[model samples]
Target: MASTKLYCFAQSGNAYKAALMLALTKSDWEPVFVDFFNGETRGDAYRATVNEMGEVPVLVEADEKLSQTGVILPYLAEQTGKFWPADAKARREVMRWIMFDNHKFTSYLATYRFLHAFAKSDPPVVAFLLARVKAAIAIVEKHLGTQPFIAGNEPTIADISMCGYLFYPKEEFGFDIAAENPNIAAWLDRIRALPGWVHPYELMPGHPLK
Candidate 1:
């Protein structure tokens, strides 16, 4: 099979999800970094290769192009046969959580993090963002209370899809995952210690990995 090529922006969690999966699966691929701050993604050259949405985390496989972090996770999992579940029922569960991450978690927490951490914050917007974060965390904590992993016992695409947004609170917001949700906190530590779990900020401009 031909190697896949992923085009991403270094500072983005959405992009990191694809990169992390590639590393975990031990797949051979090329990572092209797009400069979002410089409008590199909107360039004609990039648009021709990726979705017209101008988003990062675009995966190019031969002639195919894929956008959205949620879609990229399962695609990589299915291709590599690594994180995806084999059972029909299990696979559905994996998809369920991935959708949850996109519709529920990423919609709010990721937006909140991007706004508060990167852009100038508005007090009203920050308040609204924090409410969403709390709501998302409550849902996660409830789900994680019983299952060791999001999709149950072993890690799956669900975990990878949610890891970036989940980790953001602890590292950036001075919020402790352990204090907020012990189960998720432990899970966070395990993910952080994973083989290819590079922090997004570490790859940002002028920042060196510790």
Candidate 2:
């Protein structure tokens, strides 16, 4: 087994998507924490070396580096033969949900949570993102109403993708999703029961904010 290293920080759910996959797959991997809160991802050094996109969750194996949660999750699934779909059609279905997660589902919710809690940006901007957040959550709620997971009956990278950022505390966004969205809550509970399930804060480093 080749040595693996993940460039990540504790607070990023996007990073946790890949980190959680590593844990679930029982991969012999190590973490290289990115100082995100102190503007590390925005710096020139990180961009020049780790990832030109200046992002967290860069999975490095040998000399190759992979980023983006959608790509990273599927790559790990294929490599480990753990969470990948069984057929081409199911594979496409998984990709479809992963695309939705990257574009429609996680994007809006991540932005809303950041602006509402961490960023503390303008009120109008926060309101706009909050509207998008609700819209996205409603769609997921309706979809999960008829299914156990996002891609299919089984848990896949799609579920990992969409569930990112959602496991955060309700007070962070000043809302309780478990209280408002029962379907989503049930789905999250299902995912939580999976083997090797761990909170993002517990799995990764640089938490407790020294």
Candidate 3:
């Protein structure tokens, strides 16, 4: 068994954030697939034993079980000394972007995609989320035009967090994000070039939703 265990499914970008951190840091981790689409997360057993928050991407190391990518990312970075800034000031900058990502960037995009692709949500609700997603993406798009990464030239947890939802298929979003945003496309390219990078479907189990 690996030293670290990540509870996740392939369709969850939030989960992918932590998985990416573990992979990039070369941590000895294994994925524990959760059948989220099958209502596994809502079960009493799962709520009791795993994460009571009813979320995926729970990181388990020894007796420490961490939930939320915001917490998991920083913990993994601290543990492995990777994907985190060395200076305190730079770390602050990374945290700023990570917070933005959690509140706006990934939140909007993930919700929009889930509704657009899987939930079959009403037009009005989907439109609202889509607009929010576009607005959040535009902020990052412009920001990346000025810097190679979210916090600075180097890739940090902020970059990984911000990129959580962007790698999914364009059809899932009902549009092409990369083709529309050149700077984001370039940034994604750089991230893809990194060692130990893996697509969410290949990295975690439970793809295709069947």
Scored by TM-score, the top model is: 3
Q: Give the winner by TM-score: 1 or 3.
A: 3
Q: Per lDDT, what order, best first?
A: 3, 2, 1
For model 2, residues 20-69, the per-residue Cα lDDT tens digits are: 88988889999999999899999999999989998888999986699998
Ranking by TM-score: 3, 2, 1
Please state the error at residue 110 of candidate 2 in Å.
1.1
lDDT of each: 0.76, 0.88, 0.91
Give the clash count for model 2.
Answer: 0
- Candidate 3 TM-score, C-alpha based: 0.97
For model 1, what is the alpha-carbon lDDT of residue 184?
A: 79
Cα lDDT tens digits, model 3, 137-202, are 899999999999999889999999999988999999999999999999999999999999999888
Which portions of model 1 show Cα errors greater than 4 Å?
42-45, 168-171, 201-210
In candidate 1, where is summed lDDT lowest over 10 consecutive residues?
201-210
Worst 10 residues of 2 by lDDT: 201-210
What is the overall TM-score of model 2 with all chains considered together?
0.96
Better of 1 and 2 by lDDT: 2
What C-alpha lDDT, on a 0 to 100 scale, does residue 1 get in candidate 1?
42
Best by lDDT: 3
